[model samples]
Target: MNKSVPANVTIVDHPLVQVKLTQMRRKETISSDFRRLLKEISLLLAYEVTRDLALTEREIETPIERAMFPVLRDREPCFISILRAGNGILDGMMDLLPSARVGHVGLYRDHETLEAVEYYYKVPSDIADREVIVVDPMLATGHTAVAAIERLKKDGAKNLKFLCLLAAPEGIAEFHKGHPDVPVFTASVDKKLNEHGYIVPGLGDAGDRIYGTK
Candidate 1:
């Protein structure tokens, strides 16, 4: 919410987003509740991320009379999820853009090196022609986000945005250094990442919290 935020980042600090983020951050929050809150907060984040979507007028007949309605210029935007954790945000993003085409990129951070290793990736053939939104719940070390974006770019993606639930300053810096053209949207920018590369004051491992795997 601060006007001093970097030009490339938009923090959705709305009351509802903040309230839900608080609930999600608690260690006592159950997996079910955490998952639900992530989805809710993601929906709110989506509203801001898509604020500049292009629209065109279309004539449609209402019950009373015909009228022009504004519809997305491109009916389908590309939604790419950065693996298992990103799937959580993808679910909520889809709720907002049900018709958007979906893509998946699977990458995991190496515990020792904190580097992202890609295992799987598939995207729409027309990704170059559509605006792409990359979803990942936590942007901690940022290797994964950077790697994912690079892969997308290599595959012809041009217009791109990155969305995450929580971000670390280290991660944001690294991300921008690699892809300054892409904008980032997040619910909260936490203090910092610990030595192990986890965001301090972050809601633990987002994938673990959402899936109860840890």
Candidate 2:
């Protein structure tokens, strides 16, 4: 069977995103610097992820002139962080969208089973009525992202988008299979996953690198 990257996937190939991504991928990069890079790149990624936020025109006064300006139609999106690594992206996104509601899903992949296991979950009561942006730095096997989205949808999150720093082809395929309606925005799609389910040529364990837990 022929395979393809999902049509809903958007690659954010902006120059700054690519450059910071390279820095984060380097083994010699210190954890502090890696965390800094992740946050910086995440802001760039968030800019693209929120590009389609609803807009409305409202009357406003600009200095000596009265005119209509395009403003957000509603509250900022509700953001769900997939876990510890997800927080790295969340911080940057919050910087960009200060009014965005924040939530956390403490989901992790079982090392041996390669399945997502959720330990914690919380979100705004109005998640169903607002757009949801799910952030995680890496999408390796995709189980984590799938599980997180499943939880959100179960909670009535109708409009959702997945944002990640890097993704593997296998991961994207798996994610699409489970949630084809949700669009994915990522800085780059790498080659493949290695035997242990790590994205090939990907930055090392995002959570570990971000928190210096390794």
lDDT of 1 by residue, 1-214 (tens): 2234577898988999999999999999999999899888888888888999999999999999999999988757899999899988888888998989999999999998999999999999999999999999999988999999999999999999999998998899999999999999998888888988999889899999999998
Clashing pairs in 2: none
Model 1: how far is 121 from its true place, Å? 0.4
Model 2, 108-179: lDDT tens digits are 789999999999988999999899999998888999999999999999999999999989999999999999
Error of 1 at 87 (Å): 0.8
Prediction 1 TM-score vs. true: 0.97
> Residue 56's C-alpha lDDT in candidate 1?
97
User: lDDT score of model 2?
Assistant: 0.91
Quote each prediction's TM-score.
0.97, 0.96
